[model samples]
Target: MGKGGGQVHMGNKAFSSHSPSPPRNNSGGRGLGGGGMDRWTGVIHVPLSGGGPTFRVAASLIFSPAKTLAVPRANAILFTGDRVRGSGEPAIERLSDAAYLAGLLARKLAGEANAWVVDAACFSRSLAVYRELVPSVDAVGDPRRYDPTGFPASAGVANILAHCVHEIQSTITGTTMKDSAGIQDPNASMLSSCPPRTIILGFSKGGVVVNQLVTELACLESEPTPALSTHNLLVPVSASDVLSSISEFHYVDVGLNCAGAYISDHAVIKGIINYVLHTSKNLRFILHGTPRQWSDPNRPWIGMEKDKMLNLLQDGAQKCEGRLVLSEKRYFDGKPGSLLMHFEILQVMDIS
Candidate 1:
């Protein structure tokens, strides 16, 4: 299971603050302009409590974008879900594998010059020990059972993610910054330009985070409210930036060990529809599923929830004035659901 109690004192320092490893050629100069891009892997301690509070989750981040040496501006940015652990594999050793897969997924979606900010899970199990999948959920119990009873403080998670993006932008631009007051110092990466558009993806169990994000999307206002809560003050990114920077949210073969794998809250779906239809925001949700999760007789709720979500989103998407989209895809339909197919979907699933 994941552990968050130990990293409470990490504060808001970027993983780069700990002598970040130099950028390496991960792609071997084949796709990205005949040159691999720069990749930085580190962990960011996310503060759940406001200013000088006690709780925080250590979210591992990997910044792998098109070669920053030439094209500093990322064509797009991705905030990906955690890569699951294989039997007997250590989390430390899996970092490179996760980073590699993230890069591959980014390239598949948007050729080169894209940024991938991975929200890595602890113990390499997506959403394991610590109950919090994102800042909106309580970081206390078993995450698989972390039930979001009602509307969460939406801005909290989005703000944390946006600050991570800001840090990536700062590192790419080589901007040095003075420390900000309080434990939320990750925002120390001073922003020099507009935020890069983001595409959020949560795979397998990691879809829990994506689920919460869509819930937050429903809570976001048309004008986008400013830092309304104490925790919001910790990050530097504005509310509008959080709302507008995201272009798509992808649930890649998402499944859970519990019920309600996909979003079951109708009110949240309605809120998302209501906001995007009237507001000037364009958002798309691509629900990608494999038989491993969909056809399982043991966990049929997974497929049902995915269908309900797709239906509701599609119903609302029509009136969104091209501002919202919902796409449902079923991969590996011919092959029976198996453990191998579950993981293989990572390399073969269609992102286009």
Candidate 2:
């Protein structure tokens, strides 16, 4: 991507953002949607770096900052794991493929200057039994693991195209705030031209991916080598590229009634602790939760698990020489749990 301008690319081709969203169709997953904003929607078959199974997932993108982006131009990039939805288009429409709700969140947080937003839907969807993707089901329909491997490749690029808007700008070093929920600070002098970092977030059932990714990071000594490789809509991306680019890993109101929602295995947390403390780059973990998921009677353990994960990450951060920072934000506190509050957090999570 060139500075001051970038082009929209998908599947060995680049398109102009000067036009409105393309006509919608069921079979073709590539197109644009929402208020004439440059957007792309499609299905990508993402591979697992650890070599288990490829995810047949749907993804959506909102290009900001004068359009057209390529690898290495990102100010910041956000990978979002969507919450559960009902069957049919109504529910899933807001997620990875439909690109409605996720797009809204992108517009609110990443906007046109802060970071590029890649909101992902599950490879498959059904209902409360399970809503979002990431936790691939087993032969008997039980979730197996939460792996955020090679996801950028699934978004149609060897590296994801990025664009973001913060109050004005943001970098890891500079200081800025978009809202009460988050802050931005990119060094205009030192990092204005440097490649932006990454932020990975999982909401609701989608949070499972966040849990899995942190645990997996502990297991990585180097870049992830793929056992299988395939690309169609976008360029192929290496697992290491996605992994190394990450700076902030966020678990946003994630709870799916599945094992390891906030990491059930303590050993996995310990491994992450060691990995972050020893890593060269700085890493931060942010947890944004609401009373809806935390105080549910049906799932009372939700809050406890969230706290457990937060405490473990805090412990890890404390052990490191400020190389790793752990932070948490609780929204709608004291407010009774409600579905409105559950979905509302997406638009204003305040990921500064």
Candidate 3:
């Protein structure tokens, strides 16, 4: 119940002050610096339209009281999903569904306001489908070329998340404006001219993506970087600079299959928890799952079975230093099964 609210800003001076050592080789591919095959790359295909959106069932809806909270003008909402939904096929459909959900949140935050939505999934099939569904939204990196689905191993997830932060920063700082026209504008044009109060929303595997992005941003802010050639193009931006710009990070987990032996791997959970603890204090983590036997009582696994996942999340929230909100468990009793719960995660976001 740590409801205390405080402001954490990433200053430019801080960015100019320190430097981090080069990334060490990942040996077992588990540690932040280790090199283990990223588990996120494993793909599982799920039919989209048939399952119903998962967010509606798995997510805890927050009705903002007083119409608005005194929150940062510029916010970033990052969403990540479980592994089964991270594959090329399902990733595409899930993103498309999530876009709609994001749109809904945008409207709630700023009525009829169009916010810049970035589909950062790393499956070519998913990216293609996302583009077809919401062509106007700006997407960072090619899903096919960029493997976002593989992560929590060898910093693969962290790297993709960094890229996402960079992409958002570019749009906010007017860097993307120089790229070309037809870039979907969050406010008026596809390419956002002004830095917007941003929010990142991810589901399933997307949750891992958001976590790494936040961690990198925080780490970057702590260590400043030197000015490099912005002229080379393709050159990675200084990590410190990117981290300094982020104001807030929000992570939402929907219908997570955290109970599975393969899914509950220690490395994956530890990476996520470590990133959350070390990142900025201006963070909020929300988890939605079931309360069934699927959840491992001995571990911090969150799954959808009976409200067990939600209960575990509540427990985690208690130990967390930042604001933690747990949603009331809502079961998806459809004959088709809980698959709809997976799809609904995207459906609730109102992208279109």
Please give the ranking of all candidate structures by lDDT, highest first, separated by commas.
Answer: 1, 2, 3
Candidate 3 lDDT over residue span 1-352, tens digit each: 0121111112122111112322112110100101211110001111112232111111101111221111123333434332244445654454444333333344444321222233333333432223221122234311222121211211322232223333332323434333321222333221222233334455544544444444344343234445532221211233332333333434333322233211222333343344446654343434333222124353334433224433444455556575444334333323333444455544343322
lDDT-wise, the better of 2 and 3 is 2
Q: If ranked by TM-score, best first, what sequence of candidates would result?
A: 1, 2, 3
The backbone clash count of each candidate, in order, is: 1, 19, 72
* Top candidate when judged by lDDT against the true structure: 1
Off by over 4 Å in 2: 1-67, 71-98, 109-125, 128-136, 139-196, 222-236
On the 0 to 100 scale, the lDDT of residue 289 in model 1 is 79
TM-score of 3: 0.38
lDDT of 2 at 316: 67
For model 3, where is the 10-residue window of minimal lDDT?
33-42
Which portions of model 3 miss their true places by more than 4 Å? 1-72, 75-102, 110-114, 124-196, 217-222, 225-250, 254-281, 290-301, 304-337, 347-352
Error of 2 at 265 (Å): 2.9
For candidate 3, the lDDT comes to 0.31
Residue 70 lDDT in candidate 1: 25
